[model samples]
Target: MGITDFFSDVWDTFAHPSPDAEAPKGGSSTETPAAGTPEESSEEAEVNKQDAVKSDESQQEQGHIPSDDAEEEEEEEEETVDPKDKLEADCQESKACAPAKHHYDECAERVMGQIENDGKAKEDCVEEFFHLAHCATQCAAKPLFSQLK
Candidate 1:
């Protein structure tokens, strides 16, 4: 997906969680049917119970039995890494692009300084900023890409 789409998806995921994710807050999965409505047949409830048992057995057979809380905890752990930290770590690992990183950082500093001290608008530097950023990123990826050849 394009960067805009990707970021939009991330924003949506945070802003609007799925119904399944909100179910736990109600304290029970089985909800009582409204008055005058036919209740689920005994056979259907038994089948559902059996299915749940089978699912738990299969999960145990594979290794560990999964629970909603455990799954949520795993998801939380996976998301614990901050994006800025990941970017810094990646830059550190791309040692061959040290000069490019330095140049990119210097350019950023100069541009930001001009905007702050000289009353220049950030719109005036978007193109130059992105060009330097692209150059730096490509330079950083060059060595890694060459290894795949």
Candidate 2:
């Protein structure tokens, strides 16, 4: 049908190979023969086939490729946590959101106070979340964390 197919067909006809003609040494088409006598020698292509088959089999058994699903599950489990853990779990979730959630919450509270209450207050209660987040994260790391209080 194509140039390669036509050439391969003609080559096959001339070689007069039987239907069961064995594949070359490594099962590949390209190999250079080492040394050949006029009557008793195979082409170089066959030796290359042996090398290829050996390499392919080695790769299959050794498994050089890392597992994608396992890595992803490990990362997902990083974010996954228990709801009953409450404060500890919240700390993990806060980290997932970023450390600035408290700072932003404080800013929002100040804005709300400015809108709802007097424009000038002696002191506004600012809820600093970063400070709390840091303290909580540290506390969770301790063995006797409650003693730290």
Candidate 3:
């Protein structure tokens, strides 16, 4: 599938969750059955559970299962690392990023200060913020550009 198709499918799944995925909250339903019986509800619950198992099996068959060890390692690493530290590490890894680091830092601080002190909405600063981000991204890709020349 093309990238657009793949993203469309992902968007559809996120926008509309499957009915069997989650139970109705507070036992409320728009359509009440005439019987209103306990046995029927129990049977429906059993069917939902079976459906969930089948869904999981299908995902596994399609090679969608995640590695438990990788997940655990990621959780452990997240607990030990701060977000700012991670961003700094990412910047340090790129030779082009080093020169633009000061500019990016200044832009970030200004944007944050405006949002906090001036009560400006993040959306209001998107244009300026994205410009700074684009500059940094360009700087970070300089090495690759030089190699092509």
lDDT of each: 0.67, 0.61, 0.66
Tell me the alpha-carbon RMSD of every candidate: 15.5, 20.7, 15.0
**lDDT at position 41, candidate 3:** 64
Model 1 accuracy (lDDT, Cα): 0.67
Worst 10 residues of 3 by lDDT: 79-88
Q: Which lDDT tens digits does candidate 3 get at residues 1-149? A: 99999999999999997989987679556575556565456678999899999999999898788879868887877454444444445545556554455555666687778889878845354555455556555554655455446
Model 3 scores what on Cα lDDT? 0.66
If scored against the real structure, what TM-score would every candidate get?
0.30, 0.28, 0.27
Clashing pairs in 3: none
Error of 3 at 91 (Å): 17
TM-score of 2: 0.28
For model 3 the TM-score comes to: 0.27
Collision pairs in model 2 = 26-49, 26-50, 31-44, 31-45, 32-44, 32-45, 33-44, 102-129
Mind sharing the TM-score for model 1?
0.30
